[model samples]
Target: MRDSKLIYYRSGCHSANFTTWLIMDVIVQDVNPAISDLPCYWNRETSKSVGLQSTRKLSCLWNGVDVYLPFNFIKNYFEIFGAFSLNHGVKEFDVSHSNSRVLTPSSRYNPREEFMHFASFDVEGRSRVLCVSAGEGVPLSTQWNPQGYFYPTQIAQFALAHYSVHSQAQHRENIKRYTIQLEQEDTAARVRDEDTNSLVIQFKNTLEFALSSPHLVLSLDLKINSDIKTWFKVQLLAEEEGELFTLLYTQSGIYIQSDGSEFQFGFGNKASGRWLRLTRDLFTDLKKGLTHSNDKKKAKKLKRTKLKVISLKFYGSGNVANISLSDGEDLRMFLDGANWFLENQDENGGWPSNVIFNQGQKKYPKAAEIQPGWYGAMCQGQAISVLSRAYHVTRDQKYLTAAEAALGPFQKPVAEGGVKTVFLDRYDWYEEYPTNPSTFILNGFMYSLIGLYDLQNISPDNVIVQLLFKRGMRSLLALLPFYDAGSATFYDLRHFTMQTAPKIARWDYHTTHINQLLLLATIQNSTVLSETAERWRGYMVGKRAPHN
Candidate 1:
């Protein structure tokens, strides 16, 4: 038999095309025992009018008859009044389409109005139900208006809903499967090494974890043949979209020089054998390198460039082997250094300029020889900050006690080996040393101020600490006139009493000064100071194009 297309017949008119047909098996049942007494039958005349010429044989079910209908003829029986009491209405009906069954008269149906409920099941057992209003205040006896303009709209909505749900489920499943595959591949890659001479370290998981790490510590057991001056050539391969690019890191700095125009910035380096720590600042340098371009607009556009660390290659002169890499979160590698600091702490609750613990002697012999007075104020401030943070993380009273004791030097009068000072013309400042009377360096003072702020987190009620913090901030703010706003430069010196000013300005000093100003403004919540920091930041942006 030739297939027949389901077409709606309105009044006595039938659609001309009958080439493609959709077959459906439907069984109507009434759940209410009271409603089961009502009679229901397929409208033979209506079905024939729509080209459904064959009479479907009915079978007895629990409370209703089972009948097969051409997909087009299902709508004609929607208003079969005798199937159930009109007062109660045919609350719901089930239609078997394809492999699954759909129940209609969903929650969207209203007793006062008419609606079309559509449902379908796929071979995979997935089901979809859609409900649409026929019209507001439509009579139930009028049989859903198949010829109405909204009829096609409702059908399209149901179709779109089914397709969207199915497609979304398929898409989600595909993504989950792909993720699992990648994870397996990553695990395999971690254990497998590429055939190469030099040592190469690559992350198996997504590059995001490695790139976002604040610090990366590379530890290796290196063997060199002769006394050769050698440096490791570090390369980072990143993929953006489908294109691949490389960033190179040398002792000089990190750069990407494709067209011979390389912009490099130096991040501090440590010794070779021991763990080499690359701080968050290195990532900042990478970001700067990626965004560095001749055209400012183009540079800004590349701000969101995401670089995945596909591979890390270290090329060196001698044999580089047994390489391992760790980020900041690797507590196993971090705890060793923290333990050393705790063990070597001075009896006065302070650390010296330098402490060396000889492994053979099994004692920190250099601890006694070193003097805390020789250490710079900036170093002391950094140590205090470190200890305070250590306490914050570990909740150890020893670290807190040590941090508080370190603040004693900054609080003492200049006469006593401390930072307190009342210089010429009341130009007060935090002196680095009491003995060596010299110009106050902004960086050193700012470092101390930042340390105090960190300490303040624990001792919020310490009045003396608060006073010193405010004083340091105000003193720094007072020297703002020494800066050249036009050039975004800071003069190296601003002596007490405003005696002699140097014409020389350092670009690096200006950067540090601006950073300090911004930090102070943020912590203090001073609008004037904030505005000053903003002005300097804007000026610096135009002058040097530093990374945000």
Candidate 2:
């Protein structure tokens, strides 16, 4: 194991075992499960309870190096980890500013809302690559931001409950960061020699993704299966009065395995160590899932399904031509889930609390609200964001109308200045606690609007759409204390470019889409918006995307 270049991490332990998924571990210390004589997790100091804590520190030695981890992490570490961190993350790029780095094999980034960036990329060619990281939140997200009063100290990745990474994770813009070396590779190099040379790149977990696109038809995902065919693509259209999501497939084979396999995926923030365990578990089990199914026909069927699952395309990276995978069936499910979400949507034109089914009926949970000040409105705005995406993806006018209806009820000024947000109660559910709302719900509300606007190209007449496109400019002009040009990067900057100061925090992977929207919106009307359009067009025309 000492000389082994391939390293695997599960629950933070370097495991040579291929069976483990590279998912984050969950730790719990018991306050004592009095009823079952089980351990209890409590802080003991504040009379507060904590999860399980094991003293066992495990490690998988590699290349004379030891990667260690603590035990009792299944529940204490992995299970309770947050989906992603809310910070810009720790990535070190060369001084050039154009070159970006990846944190782990399974990681993506969220610089601001509206744009999607990679913590790092595992490239197979100049273009063929994969990013196993997530950005902090949707576009215009400032909830977890430090300067934002509501979640001021909540920037770390580990602090948030159920957040896979640590809370309070932030980027020190003043300092140049560097990615740690454990299992690292230059994706661009892979992209450079994709056809002549083949590589099997491994991420933090068992997840294995191979990208080889010589031409479209001959592309390879995991490994080059000399004997198989796989391709699934999509075409969106607006029918009679609704939108449709069309799934097309070119080739496939189905398969089933003997042993049960693990599967999971996540996106949000880059610094989040989420990819480690999940990828580990997924790739290992993926191969295992094929054990019993060597049945060529079965393999073909599964392959087809996998292709279709990956076909839903979005403008990935910084350009429109660089199409990348959207969140597959889950992305669609987000829409389907809205059907159930609609009933629970607040009477206002927005969503209610995010529902978790229990007795079969959809629920609007008032308990999760941190403060009584924001509740109904919080749920409502969230619903519109989802509904809008559903409509955009499916081209469903019905869904768009549903989204409009949901947001209609709660549209009120966020804090004044004609900057409106859905009103949400900040009161705690049981009345035992009171949490801050003004800043918290406000960010959520704005984020939802920004997210909806990210899909504006799909529906030009969206009421929320125009508001998002034009509001920030007016908001800045109104001069809200929150508009920090020095530290912020909003999507609709083009609309404000001529009015904005020269220095901007270049967050490449941020709400770039909103940037895209502005660039595309103005690119067509370059004549009228010449001064503003020229600067905005950098998103497309300018090759160098300044690093934030």
Candidate 3:
């Protein structure tokens, strides 16, 4: 009992036995009905109304080491308690910036918004990954990030989101400051602060504000007084009919009418007599609204043109305030996450995911399941890609140095607390979730490879990165066939997990896999990759390939 790792069900001091010599102690906290008599784990200041003066805390002795479970520690289904450095036995590298080279921009691999959609939560200077929960209004939570832990996959994706926004050219040289310019001082158009001061621009008949230039993002506070039969329209580029984009608020709901097409927002009286703050990417919304355009010439022109919000024509009375414009705030947010990676990296040159990933239990056996305090290839790759781009833009040597140190885990095997492993004793597979039997997740592996490629592009003369990229590419090409499941593709090679049923990719993941392959094909010219991507794309429309 003293030698084995202790497991707690999280409701009480009920312990489950597990045999392992590793440093991690896995606490499997399954969801069950709450017991009224048991101690609650909430903070004393907040949960005291329920006759609870203090939060629950547990202490135990495991393997001759004293273990303390902190207050309100059960944020997720699974939790780990241990030293992160104990898992990785590998020695740390001597980081140097003298050998660092200037990063070269490559059009071959760019961060895609579709795949990298994780939200960033900034607590202090650190960036934590936001995961979806069942809570209403606050559907997303920082999970366990308050305890100095983070999810690598989410951090990587968040970084990629920034990389995508930062790579683009800025719309203008200086930030465009917007102000309310009233055409008249009459009740029909008035700019005055109300009691709340949030709704400052009030109008009944009509109002217009002309922009000196076009902008990408628009932020404002809006209040709807009553639902009117006539539309209260806010138009952009009203002079040009072909490029006209309008936001129509009517009895039904708020709708974005753009380029002869329209789409409605959420259904409700959400903005009725209540101030609703909105921040929108006008350019992206305009593009989505034009998805069904039949005219190629008009669509091309709309895509090329910089959209401008010039006039607001209100048929019904309403209030608007705090109008502002920007190129994009993504650069700031991305840099926040990037700096987090640089600061939070462990001595082993890897970012350890403090959250336990228990999703593999459906397909993988107990032995092949992921452990807590795990490091991922996808996370490392994504972080490297982000840092490389950071160096490219700012020419900061710290980013380059951190990126080089991040390659430490790739050199070691999964058994030695790294993300590298061999599949079928031939191809080198960078495991997204490094398990006993490697789960070679297609999208994750590709993301890791993209990172290596980015690092290699920056440091072309570095033989280590060159070999890693080349070897990973070779493995990717050879293992592409195993992932193809005739009609569709599998998410990972989990068929090796006690011969479980093949885990077919979902619609979204399947699309991401196809896109990743297409991106890889741009880097390495392989007919197999191109053909597979096109064939898998056909699967989306219910096209099937002939079987022998």
Candidate 4:
């Protein structure tokens, strides 16, 4: 596919799926005036020519190709060819090797969109296909424009190029058919057949024990154009007595039977051959033995909680956050991501890569100078979360100690770190305002306190936690006077809305409003919360014009 598209196998297989790819044969240039006036290569010393590249997308060439061994084509190929994303920062990579699909929004995704039942496929009887991803274009010269961009490429051997299943209709059925609406209390996912994905559910505790209290409901009209069937699979096993499944059809539809059950049916676990006691007991006993063994990490005595902390906010609207939204599980995701970013943290503690997609749109143009990075503060907030959780759960001083290390780089002298300077323009055009920061830079500082709050929750000896707490308080207090209290919006300063564009990317306002909201609701600091929110009232509101 020339544009963004997923290439999963309709044949139902995991290894059998891969998105349509674009391949480029790149040749790095020499002494090209870099985009935004930044250096062209990762290092000026390395005489390499890196430029834009393309992939082949023809279908017939892959008639006989099999899985040639999995290779890190990036280091082996792109690095040799000098292809990389210079949209903002010069992160190195083989352009051909790095292909990614933007994940669909939750409202239009599978499970409700499709059953997500597609599993690994058996390919013994299946055939193999490969797309070379070569597009159309021809180069006439050696030098590129001042922006350091490359000309479009031509498919030289397209008729003879390695091709795969080709179709101009690559995005033919890409239209989404339904959307997911949240439940009334916002506890469950519901799908509206006629509505734009009307998905909702309410999980109030049922006084009954034998049956599950959280019943799945389907209330909607399905607008089917042609022949189609809807199916649902639910399993509540082991200690749970009953499992329920429902299929609601808008039309008088024929039901496909697997076990010959009629249109409406339900099933429960049967003891006839559920499991032999010996076998069940054998696995259970083995699991118990393995718990304390050297193999196990934390013994997982309490299941280590697969369910993590979830905030019950109104999806997309970002309106008033429900104060009661929480899942009591440790959010290890914030931790894992934080640790990964920290591990890759540039000396500035900020990740300098721009995430190009906006709202629901996707656009691509390479040159590190254009894409802005907000990773530093995002990672910082995430680090604080992880450190707090690790310390809270285990009372391990090491985790707190590790958390301390997370902010060290950000605190390093700004005169030396690249983070202190956010580029205003290529010729150094416009003047940058004081609060105009790279988004994640400020967020890192703000979230450190959040992580500390998490840590303070369970620490009995809370001394170190107290120290971090005080440090956070002082830093936050210092920020109050710096806030543009009169402004009513938040936005990234790097983006060029019209010179007359409204202020929406208010970086500090976003961080500050959220911080105030957290403190007011979470810490019960209602007095300060009112003060902060009062100033930010214009920024944090419904889709209304900025009321000065």
What lDDT tens digits, residue by residue, belong to model 1 across residues 268-345? 132233233331212323433444443334334432234333444434433333444333212222222233345545
Instruction: Rank candidates by TM-score, best first.
Output: 3, 1, 2, 4
Q: How accurate locally is residue 244 in candidate 2, as Cα lDDT from 0 to 100?
A: 28
- Candidate 3 vs. truth: CA RMSD? 23.3
CA lDDT of 44 in candidate 1? 54
Itemize residue pairs with steric clashes in candidate 1: 4-21
Q: Among these predicted structures, which one has the highest lDDT?
A: 3
Residue 407, model 4: lDDT of 48
For model 1, the local distance difference test gives 0.40
TM per candidate comes to 0.36, 0.29, 0.50, 0.29
Q: Quote the positional error of residue 319 for candidate 2 in Å.
A: 45
- Scored against the true structure, residue 299 in model 4 reaches a CA lDDT of 21
| Candidate 2 ranges with C-alpha deviation above 4 Å | 1-93, 96-334, 337-340, 353-369, 372-386, 392-398, 413-473, 476-548
In candidate 4 the C-alpha lDDT for residue 479 amounts to 44
Q: Quick one: best TM-score, which candidate?
A: 3
Off by over 4 Å in 3: 1-107, 110-149, 170-327, 359-363
Candidate 4 C-alpha lDDT tens digits along 388-438: 444544566765656554444334332343322223221111111112233
Give the per-residue lDDT digits (tens) of candidate 3, residues 82-138: 221332774222212112111222456543321232222222112232221101001
